[model samples]
Target chain A: MAHIQLPEGLPGIRGAMAFRPATARPLNDLVEILLHAPNSLTPAERELIATYVSSENDCYYCQTIHGAVAAASLNGDEALVKQVKHDFHNAAISEKLKTLLVIAGKVQRGGKHVTTEDVTAALAQGATDIEIHDTVLIAAAFCMFNRYVDGLATIQPRDEAMYRERGKWIARDGYVNVSKEYLPAEVAR
Target chain B: MPHIKLPEGFAGISSGFVYRPETAKPMRELAHVLLHEPSTLTPAERELIATYVSTQNDCYFCQTSHASAAAAHLANDWGLVEQVKHNYERAPVSEKLKALLTIAGKVQQGGKHVTSEDVAKAREQGATDLEIHDTVLIAAAFCMFNRYVDGLATWQPEDPEMYAKMGQHLATEGYLAPSIKA
Candidate 1:
């Protein structure tokens, strides 16, 4: 049971966002622009950053749902998503992404954890300025998402199928409308 | 100096947001909604959450900038703001705000650190569901904001006046305005 009276079925951010649609509007907009907007970083790669940060924060719901999204987007490569979490250094992702992940991980631990050498290494790996910026933003954003969901004590369903389904939904349709569809009737207003 | 060649003279997130206005739009809007829009918690209280979380993260840019905003909103109560940041438990804020700050601190350490007992304690202090929700969100969001500013090694001016000016701008016009009012 959630600490608050969030809707029973909706999970993680969905329920928490539903709890306050005003905040949801901008949050979903930010997620949509950050993840789905056309950019050098593929949506799969971006979702992986979000997943990795959530995993570090130990927010089960965020990591699972985003892991599923990364998997669905990567031709259903759930194994690849797991690899990125376990040891992204060994994952099949490119050297550039590996470097980006290093930066993201540092940010996950603490902002000051990232150093000048990390940026130099990432630039050496061919990550553009915006790619590095977005990677940091993506990682930073998930810390908030992770904290918001768990801090609220929203119901975090462990059923694998549920996450897989939500993952496919977000990966396919994206976040803006998905937020609206999932909101409780009164809150949706 | 920012790791990226962001426009110079812009402070902290100002430089980064300019570097990527596409990302900045929603981020600024999110800030407005979370801290500016109508809520059970006062804007000062919300700004305090952001400032306190930044202090915990040791992000000098975020902590100072937001402390200014909190103080500006509270009749330039810089002393009050510092007291809350140093020791919120004994600070002059309402009991409800103290409880919410407890949850915010846990979120800063890491999200899972916040427990159900914390939530119950907050509710006992008369925090509404929305107040609890906003408190966590403010803390969580500041973590992101603090990291975004510091991750790239964005430049932060050392002068307190700069932060006071930025703080006054944010408190007066809110985050929906362009961060660089100068």
Candidate 2:
């Protein structure tokens, strides 16, 4: 049972977001810009950062959905997604992404846990100032997103196939389109 | 020194936001809507939620500033704000607020930590669905806001009086107006 009276059939943040479009629009807009907006960081890399942070937070729904999205963006490399979640340090990824993942992990632990050394290392590994900034923002945002989904006890689908299908749509269509398509009629209020 | 070369004389999240106004615009707008806009939950109660979460995160700047804002709204009851921070259960507040704070505290720890019993407790205390929802958002959002401030290692003011004065302005001016005023 959902803690709050959310609409039927909507799961995770989608349900909660539909319940309150007033707050949802801005929150969704933020995600759209963070993940889908043009930047030096590839969409795949950004999704990986989100996936890694969601995994660290132990948010089952977010981790699964975003993991699938990251995998789809990386040419259907679902194993890489699992590897990154289990242990990105040992995963087959670029050195730069590895360093960014380190920073993202620290942000998940606590803000103060992110030290000057982390930034220095990322810089040494060729991460731009903007990439570092975005990584922290992504991690920080997911903390909020993960908590929002789980804090409300939103329903989460358990099937891997479901996440993969959603991930494919999100990768091709982006968040704005997916949100509009999936949003229920009454909840749009 | 901020990690990003934020403009001098700006401290904490302010400097960081100013550094990247593009991201800051929507964020500040969201805070304005969430904290200042009229709702079932009064601005004071909402500020208390922000302060509570910031305290949990141990972000000195956020806790101090928001504590002052909450105090100013509560007719300068600084001690009450401090009590909430030290121990909300012992503090003199509504049963509903106590239950909500319990939920907020759980959110600060981790989302999974919140249980069905916690929600039932809040609802039993007469917390509406919107109130419970907002409480969770406030707690969750503060996690982001706190991390934004502390993650960048921004400078924080040391004087409690400074926070008190800012709180006064914020109480009267509201978040959107005060953010522009200060």
Candidate topping TM-score: 1
- Worst ten in a row by lDDT for model 2 chain A: A180-189
Each model's TM-score, in the order given? Answer: 0.96, 0.94
Candidate 1, residue B50: lDDT: 92
TM-score of chain A of each: 0.95, 0.95
RMSD of each: 1.8, 2.1
Instruction: Report, for every candidate in turn, its global Cα lDDT versus the true structure.
Output: 0.87, 0.85
Model 2, span B4-76: residue lDDT tens: 5557777677776766666776676677777878888889899998999999999999999899889988988
For all predictions in the order shown, the interface RMSD in Å is: 1.1, 1.0
Minimum summed lDDT over a 10-residue window in model 1 chain A is located at: A180-189
**Cα-lDDT of candidate 1:** 0.87
